[model samples]
Target: MKNYTITVNGNVYDVTVEESTGAAAPAAVSAPSPVKKEAAPAPKKAAATGAEGSVKVTAPMPGKILGVKVSAGQAVKKGEVLVVLEAMKMENEIIAPSDGTVASIHAAVGDSVEAGATLATLN
Candidate 1:
């Protein structure tokens, strides 16, 4: 028999495994009840500079902003890359919706964003 201790989300548990000489399955071990603890509230993000524009550019999936390709007031064409988002170990280009100037960039490089969260805007 072998014993192991593991911690998950700050909760600790003991696990045991039994060696089998044959093909039979090992017995399951029940862990002790975990203590209930209150989780801390999430921190809020500060508002970005400039007001949001008429056309919103949002994230398709939750990811970290890898790069900001355009700055405020920069002219862009339809389908131009505005930001590079890293999700699922892949880089996705967030593009502009139409030919317009970049109104504002709500998210910066390295900022963690949720799906449908605003990354930038065009006007």
Candidate 2:
């Protein structure tokens, strides 16, 4: 099977197709395609406060933290990864909520976190 993304009316659709073979045909053929709807977009991250203030970092999805990139008191960029979470056999890096100092870490490596769970705090 093969997958592809098609755009129609300015909207994107994911489609999968299966290949077919026959003895009489010199070449392969493809079956009818199937379209799969993708999940809705995730909520937007909270606005960044450049000044001194606590920024709540939330998990993007349910997953286990495979690695931690920032420690408390460490300075970070606006989109720096503070943790890496493994979900659906894929590792996803959790970025900092804002450009500031790492105030605290709520979840540690090997810890499982649900979507929207507090992962860290930034100053």
Candidate lDDT (C-alpha), each: 0.86, 0.75
RMSD of 2: 10.8
* Residue range 36-86, candidate 2, lDDT tens digits: 555557655443223333788888889988998887788999989889999
TM for candidate 2 is 0.56
Highest lDDT against the true fold, candidate:
1
- In model 1, which range of ten residues has the least summed lDDT? 32-41
Give the clashing residue pairs of candidate 1, or none: none
Tens-digit per-residue lDDT, 1-123, candidate 1: 887666667666666777778877766666555545544455678467576789999999999999999998899999999999999999999999899998888998889999999999888
Q: Estimate each model's TM-score.
A: 0.65, 0.56
lDDT of 1 at 87: 98
Any idea what lDDT model 1 has? Answer: 0.86
Which segments of model 1 are wrong by more than 4 Å?
1-41
Could you report the Cα RMSD, in angstroms, for every candidate shown?
5.0, 10.8
